[model samples]
Target: MLQRRRLLLLLSAAGCAQRPREPSEAAAAPLPAGISCVPFARALSGIALAGDAHLWWHAAAPRYRRGTVPVPGAVLVFRRSARLPQGHLAVVVRTVGPREIRVTHANWASGSARGQVAEDQSVVDVSPRNDWSSVRVWHPASGTLGVTVFPAWGFILPPRPADPAELAARVPVAARLAAGTL
Candidate 1:
C-alpha cells in the first residue's frame, strides 16, 4: 500500500509539472489608454487637487505642505521625465514601514478597465541615500516590484482638517459613554 501511494504521488507531481502556466489577468487584459492618474486620484481622495501629475507638487507648494514623510491622505508627487511624460500621482493609503507605504492610484496597472484603479498597492523607497527620492512600485501584471525605480518630488499634505461634527456623528453617544469620555 505504501509503495502504491508513493507511485501516485510521483505521478501527481509529474502531471502538475507538465501543465503550462496560464497568463495572469493583468497580462491577458488590454493596456489602459487615455486614463490619467490625476483625475483618478482626485476622485478617490476627494482632495480637490488639480492639474497634471507633474505639476501637483509645484501647485501644492503654496497651499499644501510638502515633505518626504509619508502620511495617509497625502498625495505622492512623481516628477516629470522622458519615460513618464505627464508624471503620476498616488494617494497614500497608509504607511507599512519606515520606507514602505501602500497607495491607491490609476494607470499603474496597464490592462485595467475604465476607471479601474489599484488600491493598497505596495510602494518601497529604494533610494540609495534613503531620502525617498526614488521608489519602486509593485506591478500587478508581472507580479513583482517594478523594474523602473522612478524619482519622486515628495508628498503633499492637504491643509484642511477633518470636520469635528463629522467625527462626533460617527461615535454613538452610548459607545462614548461606555468609554467614560462622553
Candidate 2:
C-alpha cells in the first residue's frame, strides 16, 4: 500500500507540471480558436499601436470609415450624419491577416500622433504592448472577406456592414483584396 500511494503522488506531481502558464506571461502566444477581435488582430499584425495618449492609433489603415467597414487592419472612418452608415464613425480593425474589425463611436476617436476630439471618431490601433487592447478585428480566412486601410483623404464608399452573424454565416464573398482593389 505504501508503494502504491507513493506512485499515485508521483503521477499527480507530473500532471501538475504540465499545466499551462498564465496568458500575461505568454505574449505573442498563438490564440485559441475564436478569441475576441482585439487579440486576433495583434497576433496577425506583428505590431500593435502603443501609447498612453487618451486616443487611438492604427497600424492597419483602412480607406473609408463608412459603409461596411473593411477588415484585418487599423484605420479610421469618420461621419457627420446619422444615416444608415451614410455618415458615421468607426475604426477599421485588422492586421497582416485576412480578417476585419469594425468598432465605431458616436463621439470618440484618438490617435498616437493626433489628439482627441468628438466627431463620431472611429479608426484607431492600440499598442501591441497593450496586449491587444483597442486592437480591432473580426475573423480570419475562415470568412471570405477582406478590406484595405487607406489614407483618410481618399475615402471609398465602403461595402455593407456584415452583421457578426452574417459574417459567420459563410456567404460567398471575396477572400483577399487591396486598399483600392475593391
Count of steric clashes across candidates, in order: 0, 29
lDDT of 1: 0.59
**Which candidate wins on TM-score?**
1
Where's the lowest-lDDT run of ten residues in candidate 2? 171-180
Model 1 residue 15 lDDT?
9
Q: Which tens-of-lDDT digit does each residue in 63-179 have in candidate 1?
A: 778888887767788887766677778777678899998775655555433324455577899988776789988876677878888889988875543232332232232122212
Off by over 4 Å in 2: 1-34, 50-55, 58-182
Candidates' RMSD to native: 19.9, 20.1
For model 2, what is the alpha-carbon lDDT of residue 49?
26
Candidate 2, residues 27-133: lDDT per residue as tens digits? 23222321111212122221232211111122124422422324423323322222212222233322232222343211122122111111111233343343232
TM-score of 1: 0.66
Q: What is the TM-score of each candidate against the true structure?
A: 0.66, 0.18
